[model samples]
Target: MTSAPQLLTDPFLQLPTATSVQVVWFTEFAGVNHIVTYGENLKQTARASTTKLSRTREDQQSRVASQNQDGQVYQKPVQRDIWRHEAEVTGLTPGVRVNYRVTSVQEDGKSVDSDVFSLAATPKSDTPLKILLTSDHQLKPMTAANLQKVVETVGRVDGVWFAGDLVNVSDRASEWFDDNGGGALFPGLQGRAKHEMTHNGVKTIYTGGQIIQHAPMFTCIGNHEVMGRFARTGSLNDEFDDTIPRVVAQRIYPDKSLIDNSFNTNTYEEIFSLPKSKEGEKRYYAVSFGDTRLVVLYATNMWRTPKLDGKFKGRYREAEKDLNNPENWGYGQVIYEPIAKGSKQYNWLESELNSPEFQQAKYKVVMFHHPPHTLGDNIVPAYTEPVQIIERDSDNIKAVRYEYPKDADYIIRDVVPILEAANVQLVFYGHSHLWNRFVSPSGMHFLETSNVGNTYGAAWGDRKREVPIGYQEDYVKLGDPNGLEPIVPTIAPLLGEDGKPMPYIASNDITVFSIFDTGTGTVSSYRFDTRKPDSEVLKFDEFKLKLSSLPLPPGNKFPG
Candidate 1:
């Protein structure tokens, strides 16, 4: 049998024109580089043509895992999010059909390639589009049933909305050991004729690349990819010391710089080579498919800075001048810097919103990392409190460190308004790491899809958290429907002013999973406990998207 190509570039296809599609792949022509070939599949059989460029230093994340057997901890090689060498092909007419693959050069001067995949360009939508949406796919190959779930998704839907968090951190532990040749193509089946049994009693399979290669995906960044670097204490303005900007914690000891860095999804980036952002660069941007317009925002950057307006940010530092406080001087300063709206990104976003291109789109959906709405009654009680400082563009207010204007300022002041005025219909965020959806008073949908990897609890809204501390519309809990009494909420306890149980409410399985159609006007929620593959849907039919009938054009984007 012919051996696989050494290294293959991802993102097998691109749409340059309405009908033309470009196919990209990798080959070891000079070094690890990309080769793209295209033609009208409609004209005779398309012939393969090629181009080659070395894999940028960051492109080669392929490595074998190794470990020390002292019962201490095993270490594995870091995985680049995607395959190497992506082809950005275009010049196709819209609504045309095409097929492609990734041809990669391996370390042995040989090459590897992905299975052939195909897609039909965006045909002018005659009806509201139906995009299959699912997120938080935390698959562990250790079990048999879990592996089945991966197989189950193949050919099941039109296209997939793969929100982030694709692997288990511990899953790569095998990289530290070698049951196979050198790498981790398959965790347990190294030389076996077939992969018939499960590993560690859990089902496992390598399906990520397979799914991505075939599906013309509308992907969203998830918290798991950046959860380690997420500092919820404040905002992205919070500073860190990594000049190189690491994505995932390369070595694992909770490196501080990993705070805003990550590469988990980078593997997907390499394999798929999706569209990238102009300023922040790839991973956070919009993707349009036919009638769908997906606005991808970067939320991890939002909740990084700690809440410290001009007066108090340095207050703790100044007090530590003598260095004898026992409690570190930086204790309350919030590790990152104080954020302001006057920065360049704010202006760029405002301009993007004002663009006729953005406004003309029928459906506008925005995706990022942090939740704009508070899910529980315990934390801030309400979503709005003056947390961020707004001195330039507009809006001004002040309060406690985490209050709306001070810490929460970015979401409300810099981002949300632009989306709202620009006619964006839905927003999706994941930093909180659970399934949640909050509808704003302004008739927009706020959806959060996290927990693809790990999970925590979610707090329900409490009337008290809203009155005393809430300032934003999302934080202010609206009354529950007549028959939909809320499941009790829970929040971690801290000494209350009165020293009582804070009584915050949070739910664990309130995860967001369901079939949603912009045309149907509703998202019926379902909870699947992946722990036991076929476990009954935990909360059977408890929540339903309260779709507002306010008429809008059919959307081509997803509310990430």
Candidate 2:
């Protein structure tokens, strides 16, 4: 017998305007009626528009239903039907919170109702807002613990600025709703997770903070959010890693849509209704939230494996067997979208940065996926498109390799200059799973506070990235490749083995999170050791946003 149809996720707030906010929810069945009930007595109702998800699927590795058994339920990737319902709760009083709930009635007359939650329209300019600055959850180990501590420490946040990488696989349905392990995206953010974490031989179950259900969340397209070419027979992971440059895809499949042949963000775009830009739609856009003007850029590229033994297609070279076929090449971490000077995204950004809205805002912030400056390994090899170099023996191809020119690093060479010139206060990003911050010479702050879960060890002193040693481009094995020094935490920085303060927190046991307080003009970073379930959350770093255009020397210490 089939189970009863139920809601896949709790209603979450999105795209908050002055007088309205979008309430979005999901379900396994296409319901006949889906509505959001709000107001004092739950008398007000808004009918919802339901649409089926296009690309969500489940593979053998998925943790759902019978798939969670010892043996694989799905031998190959298969579609998992899911429907999304969204309703705009209009005529709301700005900053006035009201109780709201969602209900969906199936074809058989059975209905499911979500728990009552509080929501409000956008706040006023002078309103005090504590926005969560986080990214790279990707259903990692400590994500539940990290978010749980967030609620315990600061209560509900006014908004969420998620830089990217919400899940490991963009089209995986279980990863977003219920992964069975209780670390799914919706569960973690909606306080419905049952994720268990064990440290020091003690076990604890964590329900992530109740945040996004109340406050709207804005997200960027991280590399993990973009799935490559579609594959009907093979593993979903193979299709995810099979992305090619648009130019190459066009040359190969002249009649196919770029999204179909190259790569697509259909699932990510379908999940969130974010503010749109004239040039890039939801892929990259700018939104005004109270005292802040936030610009989110599509500044991430395909992340290829770093292996170089010719046994796998990696960041530097193609696999030996695939060297002969141009269509099968990984293309060396090619960028998905161009943000270089004169490009569409760059032009839009340049205009947005100079616009009256951005200029007048109390805080101007830019967010993206890839790190412009970080101590983690993912920052190396530059952020520009790879230059393909073919090695041929006579007429036969021997090997296919790629190189990145430091001068062509788009984020560092193009985007940062424009942001610095416009006096952007903060540049937030993630990709490298670590907590690090840097201040540019023009006093612009670069913060990557995404140490929410596991970390790939930081590259400093003795630790180094696995960069190509004898490549034409000089990849800096240590320090920030963009030539900026990371700022040490102003209070209680984590100590290294040498007993000195470490600037970055790259730990598996201790997770970190950051809050951007618009009222105080400060961003405070906090950390919690998951190893000690009952331990206090420590505020490790806090820095005031620079208001003036005065140039600060590189590596200038932040004042407490």
- Best candidate, lDDT: 2
RMSD to the true structure for each prediction, in A, is 11.1, 4.0
Cα deviation at 112, candidate 2, in Å, is 1.3
Candidate 1 lDDT tens digits, 432-520: 44554555556666655444333444443233322323334243444321112222212222233566543222233222344445454
**Which regions of candidate 2 are displaced past 4 Å?**
1-4, 69-71, 548-560
lDDT of 2 by residue, 139-193 (tens): 9999998899899899999999999999999998999999988889999999999
* C-alpha local distance difference test of each model: 0.39, 0.90
Task: Please identify model 1 stretches exceeding 4 Å from their true place.
Answer: 1-17, 20-83, 89-93, 105-111, 132-210, 218-284, 302-342, 376-408, 461-525, 531-560
Q: Which one is best on TM-score?
A: 2
